[model samples]
Target: MDFFARSLAIAGLSVSLAACAGAPAQSRPAAVAQTAAAPPPMAPPGPCALRPSCDTPFPAPSKREFRHNRSGLLASALGPRHRGRDLFLLPGTPQWVLGKFAYGPADKDLKDEDIDVYLLRGCGAAWEKVGTYRTTEDEGSHPAVVGVADEGGQIFVNLAQVLPGGPLGVGRHRIKMVVAGDGTSVDLFLEVLPAGARIVVTDIDGTLTEKEEALVGDVLTGNHSQTHPGAVDVMRSLSGRGFFMFYLTARPHWLEPRTREWLRLRGFPPGIVHTSVTATGRMGGAAASFKSGELSLLKTATGLLPELAFGNMPSDVDAYWSSGIPRTFYYKLADDARGGVKHDDYRTLLPSLGELPAVCP
Candidate 1:
């Protein structure tokens, strides 16, 4: 069998063993194609490359809030599994994020812009830094970038390697990032969930949130806020039932903090919110491609498929179907010819376990 087909069979075997959650997982010969490979390294850009005035033609920003805007860590839901066909899942498994340095306030720009990121553990005043990570230079692809001003100053930080285990233990963890130049800092939060038999995947816009009939501007701006009724309650119910929730959206990476904050403020259960990093993510097939790709990675990396998926757009249905979620389980907010389960809102959808077999292998 081909690699993907063999992996599916292995996943099926895992489902058959679901009744015996305590049984030892099966072991199999390692496939050469399953090995994890490090990403290719590129030459580090100069320190000030991310600033507007740092380079020719582009000028620094006049506003202060713009200094650190659109900067934070990416979230991870599933931890790395020690054994399985997905043992070596890389890009999506090991926690990583693009870190940006905050510049300017009193027109005093920083020269030494190295950043230090720490993983904070515990809640007391004695909170300790459990891990520290170094940043690798990379170009930012945010769609809102004007000219070439903010492209070069970004860096990628990997937290998985520095954590106690490859996967963080189940709990809430806060990441602290500090720019060595002006002492400016920011914090991002993430939670590692306990292993469960099924996962709940849903789209953000129009699926979980309510959209007005005639609002024409950007629907996913950082400040755009409106969610459907009972959306949070339904997700909370599913979370209580032991299904890991994943929010898949076509929004850009820069809006991650806003999206996360919206979900938190609205009482939704905590889960990783996946967004697009590319400048062209909303164009053409970008959204569908990204959602489908992430779903595929989730399955390939952890061998778990989403037991239930909720979406509104045709792209969502297409992506969920491509990711192997059943049409009956793929619920849509609107009735369409796509043939997935239809729901007016999340109020009536009670996610049930035991429907999806446990993922193994």
Candidate 2:
């Protein structure tokens, strides 16, 4: 059988074993009891009698309130000193305004002369310039203001206030900030999230493995393709702490079973596995657009919003950034070859295996 088919078979076996292990035990009956006989069957009711009138009132809307903190942590081990905020928006709500852009010290060193924020929705071909604000100096504590300005420091237009509108929908939204100074610009995107959902999506290849190249040579054929140190323990701890975990990859669907089995063997829990459509081609890194689309679809199917994401590639960052989810924990192999110990964002790194925190509020 091909790799995918074999993997499916293995998954089936594992599922069967899991089912058996979960079967409920039977209870013993009481000793010696006298029983009575049953009565004969009666005639069926007439059609008119069977069709009894019943008025079912519409159920009242649920009153339970959904509450969650709107704050989140931003950690980057890459040393650039990342800073950002987490805004909580209602699912399906229309894009809300982020108010105004305040130029910071970083803006002073810009090669470009102006800064702009763009709204990228639905990972498609176009992005809308919803609002644009500029700063007088590259560095300052200027008061907040709205509207667009020209290169000569003249106000061109006043943009509308950032307001929220849209039906109840949920998922991540990415906001890209472009700072143009001198003759260059840098694009920094941050994710926004809805409340209550706490899912974690991770890529499986280089981010979690030392094999920096081809999957066939590094993972499929080599015995060295094992889980990174501390990976399994962290995953187990997260699972125990009530965080839903999933593996999202551009890997072919045919590899699902083997990949699932590999993860199971490596101590990762059984969570949803997303693979690309066969027509999309083979095991390759998905485009940021493609991953963004998948993230939307997954959000709909699972009814859970991911609060944090983890991965190592630029594309992964792009995808997560666009989805609008808050909190991203990125990692790279330590430069000194001290294994995976050294990391860029160690503040939010998983606690050591035995030191995992309790899940209680």
Candidate 3:
């Protein structure tokens, strides 16, 4: 939970305007309909309303750091230096396809670097050129019509500008960024959700993995991760039922890429991943605050709180309670009478999977 907010930021990979609030995810034979509360009166279609996702109150710190440049073997070992910030938006809101760029083993931030951007519908192999953008020195995203990256390693390629005419469509799309210097690139995701979509949000370190320190132990010892037994099947099944899976964690910013990699490696359902860039989360005692704050942003953006949530910390309980999520489960805790259920076995919920609602259009 200590790493929750930064992870939400790193793990904060998403939002869905006009999403719905509903009961805890349960299995029943009936198809359920989400209880979508009406969204705030949207500003009439205009420049402001057309804006894509932006940095929340706590935006990422875009600080440039210099390091001994790395290439080839060493660079490959440290993994991809550039990572695009994945975004989720309701159709009306355009997306600022943002990314962080760096080079070498230490992820030395790159600036004034030229990049080629491309778009691939449905993540197919065929790619289409979008534009040529440059990494500038700005920390905040104010992407021009062309596309841009800030010195803080942040890139903002506005969807309204690239795919002009309308907001990006529903379903997943890929945004590719190729560094002009090395011809190397990274692919980030853009999940465009429809109004009143159903979503399931969860934390990673403990909620998904076997325990809070499990991930750290695995990373440090170079061992395979140990996920809670049914975590994978349960999440994948939820996705199959048309529920959007949100993997919100409190990991640090730099870990976002790895976090996504781990989820993919572990067979967790595909979804946006968010990690925090804040210095105060987790051990700093801001995990709950970060989560509630982020949840509040999501509530306003999507017009609904998550229908179901999972976690394993007091902070998680606190965050969910404040967000008013109806169904929240903690893997480790006993059932709390106030709220939240004591449940961890995902397989047990499989029989009644149909009870969960299909996402609303």
Top-scoring candidate (TM-score): 3
Tens digits of per-residue lDDT for model 2, 1-361? 1222224334434433433353221100000111122222323321111111111221222222111111000000000111112133334433333212211211111121244555444322445554445433332333322211122221122222342333213323333443322111112122233344456677676655544343333222322256566665455555555455567766543343345445545556434455443312223234456667767765654455676576666666777777876766556633232112335443346544225333421
Q: Lowest lDDT 10-mer window, candidate 2?
A: 70-79
Model 3 TM-score? 0.71
Please rank every candidate by lDDT, starting with the best: 3, 1, 2
**Lowest-sum lDDT 10-residue window in model 3:** 25-34
The C-alpha local distance difference test score for the whole of candidate 2 amounts to 0.38
Between prediction 1 and prediction 3, the one with superior TM-score is: 3
lDDT of 3: 0.59
Provide TM-scores for the models.
0.57, 0.39, 0.71
TM-score of 2: 0.39
What is the clash count for each candidate, in the order shown?
Answer: 3, 20, 26
Tell me the tens digit of each residue's lDDT in model 1 across 52-94: 1110111121222222322221001111111001011223355
lDDT agreement of model 1 with the native: 0.45
